[model samples]
Target: MALTWIRTHDWDAGTWRNRSACRDTDPELFFPIGATGTALDQISAAKSICAQCTVTRECLEFALATNQEAGVWGATTEEERRKLRKSWLADEQAAAG
Candidate 1:
């Protein structure tokens, strides 16, 4: 037997990527190197940039929809994103039920 699964998202809507405030910043800022204080600072800095982004909502939606497991996105760190995803799933389940 053969089994396969596919993943998809509104890539066309990802036009926001072209305007991302972090686009010109060091990509490393979005990906903290560890759980140390320096890493937390990096995450904070990345999020600050996201705070000023006009496309922040789009960036967040895309990150959530894609279940991004790493890096800062839309002013949220990995742990924060995890919590948001959990809450979002709970909301979806409640709505569906």
Candidate 2:
């Protein structure tokens, strides 16, 4: 099958995005419900879907690289990503010192 391409500001056709399991799923699965608090059921559902995705790590890395502030990516909630960003920044600062 010819690979379906999606618009991304990051990597080009050379990346693994073509193989993403979330490619065919609803786009909203990666974002929060409208104006509603992030419910555990919703997060669990998204994470469960991500758990089986082959490109989960790539997706997470993309979110981190792009500083995505909202939505679920690669089985992680927004808060999780926030903590990861903090940790990554700390590691970078430590390495630079």
Candidate 3:
């Protein structure tokens, strides 16, 4: 049996994107049903679902390995992961500098 890649969706394009891609995401996807409070709330709801998902670990691994810039996944917030990524990039830059 072949493994099926799961996507940690963050937005509309992602929600509707082809499932062929192993890992994919978008940070701007939001639910506009009714009077939505804010993007933050939408992200929070999505994160809650992600937390209970079966493929969360794999999703998180993929997001981190790919150095995803934004989107909610892997028990991490966008700002949190971005800071870590920036530092990693800085280290790499310094090593090459």
Candidate 4:
């Protein structure tokens, strides 16, 4: 899939949030304390929901754009997003150049 970069100025475009699969779910499920045992379970559960979400890309883009340091967005864990954010930033820079 092609990456779509979202600007901070467009953070207000949150209409897709209402259409998210985890909207009604527990917010804590997405924000785990660690990446082991129970946290892993939480991540798995959150990802399952994301897997079924139509606005997952939008959610992930928002997380990446806003630099969300925690939680599972777009089916990715905190560590996962951190690595992806680096690549995302590189890609954005390259695109801008």
Who wins the TM-score comparison? 4
Cα lDDT tens digits, model 2, 29-94, are: 677664356566667777888888887766776776678888888678788888887765565466
Error of 1 at 6 (Å): 23
Total backbone collisions, model 3: 1
Residue 24 accuracy (lDDT) in model 1: 98
lDDT of 3 by residue, 1-97 (tens): 1223333333223432233222343444423233336766766766766665655555554555577656665545666566655554555456557
The deviation in Å at residue 25 for candidate 3 is 12
Of 3 and 4, the candidate ahead on lDDT is 4
**Which runs of model 3 end up more than 4 angstroms from their true locations?**
1-37, 83-97
Clashes of each: 0, 0, 1, 0
Candidate 4 matches the true fold with a TM-score of 0.86
Task: Flag clash pairs in model 1.
Answer: none
Error of 2 at 51 (Å): 0.5
Q: In candidate 2, residue 10 scores what lDDT? A: 46
* Ranked by lDDT, top first: 4, 1, 2, 3
In order, the Cα lDDT scores of the candidates are: 0.75, 0.68, 0.51, 0.84
Error in Å for residue 44 of model 4: 0.4
Q: Name the 10 consecutive residues with the lowest summed lDDT in model 2.
A: 1-10
What is the lDDT for 8 in model 2? Answer: 48
